[model samples]
Target: MSDFFNNKRVWITGASSGIGEALAHAFASQGAHLVLSARNEDALGKVAVKCKELGAGMVSVLRLDLSDHDSIPGIVRNMIASVGKVDILINNGGISQRSLALNTSLDVDKKLMEVNYFGTLAVTKAVLPGMITHQLGHIVTVTSLTGKFGTPYRSAYAASKHALHGFFDSLRAELGDTRIKITLVCPGFIRTNVSINALTGSGDKLGTMDEATDKGMSPERLAYKILAAIERGDEEVYIGGKEVLGVYLKRFFPGYFSRLIRKARVR
Candidate 1:
């Protein structure tokens, strides 16, 4: 069991599947108390059961739709009341887009922003006060590699991720005096249903996985890295194959990186 997460009250969003589900197993193995949240109540229940089997001391399931930003605070408050204080908040629930900006509808963009940006912010705000009062907390987000740089066929998705980086980075700076730690986990690509469920130009599901995603890193591996980053109190970390190098390339050679991305087939 990991000493850092042992008995910690950790709340994980998107716990229904993919990276979230993998993370649930990883944290449970360390004997953490878990609050698993996702839009699908049934799926969350399944994950909770698995968590218990994996050695979690406590496990609770909460249904949360990130698209319903307005109701997030109420949901979070009720959760906190039942689960006690939240030691860590994993803002991992979000959708992905697969269309170009020119072909995408405004509604699609709005929905993406609402779920990936506003919804995350609302949950963090609702949980922040308690963490602040207790003077101990950690906020971890599963941002994508696109958060650091632009890529083809993911304009809205990239925008939402970039916004997360801006908000969390600023929040970290503002909370410098506090014990609250913010870790932004940037994953290049992970084998999941993100591509299959990605929004299209007309706000429809893409309904198919891409080649890159099919060959991406396993969710379980990414989960292990994320847990380590959290334990180390890393402000930010990248997890993936060669795709992760894009972050450094974009930083050191923006002009070259921009040109290279233009010719790259992201999807």
Candidate 2:
């Protein structure tokens, strides 16, 4: 792993905490140069220090808010100015939702799309030109299991993730002749602040963790699987416990899976 990633310039969004932070540690241990971005600059700074201590060749902190799509080009410019060209870009910044389809406000759905789908798309576009010019780069998106199939309480969230899968899958086909590769990582659930930070029907934070999220896999373990998938150039990968089986269930047993999901306890 160290030999594969040593001195590679990697950029990760949502690096302030959770899976993103764990990925920072994982990549740092492999001696990768890292650019960590998130809305919280102070938190990013703390994570940057930890990455340095973990043996990162170089670590830089950049403030990035996925909702602020207008500022993305400038951020990418600054990143290129500082780090030259990124070898890999981990599109990990996004918001989750725990709201019902009918109860959720239209504004909340728009906000979800703005941050989860368009925001990631914006960042990927900004970083793509350089990668195209260099003829080498890996684009990784941290999608969700919901991306594969819609689930309860995540209508908007699942839609946004599903859009990413469409966009990236098409982008990969378009760039098939290029050296650049795209990998979409679908994580079922992880013990993180995601549930607590999930948006509600009123567009406010849920402010509480769900039982499923609280008992999910650790961020560190998921990060390892993600990096391994990137190394292997996998087009798509799923990481989770038994919940990941839902993907296959939906695929091979759509009727049963649909009925099961109807009765499943998502929250």
Query: Best-fitting candidate, measured by lDDT?
Result: 2
In lDDT terms, how accurate is model 1?
Answer: 0.94
**TM-score for each predicted model, relative to the true structure:** 0.98, 0.99
Candidate 1 TM-score, true structure as reference: 0.98
Candidate 1 Cα outliers beyond 4 Å, as residue runs = none
* lDDT tens per residue, model 1, 32-136: 999999989998999999999999989999888888878888998899888889999999999999898999999999999999999899889999999999999
Score each candidate by Cα lDDT.
0.94, 0.94
**lDDT (Cα, 0-100) at 168 in candidate 1:** 98
Worst 10 residues of 1 by lDDT: 1-10
Task: Report the lDDT tens digits of candidate 2 across residue range 3-81.
Answer: 8889999999999989999999999999999999999999999999999999999899999889899999998998899
The Cα RMSD of model 1 versus the native structure comes to: 0.8
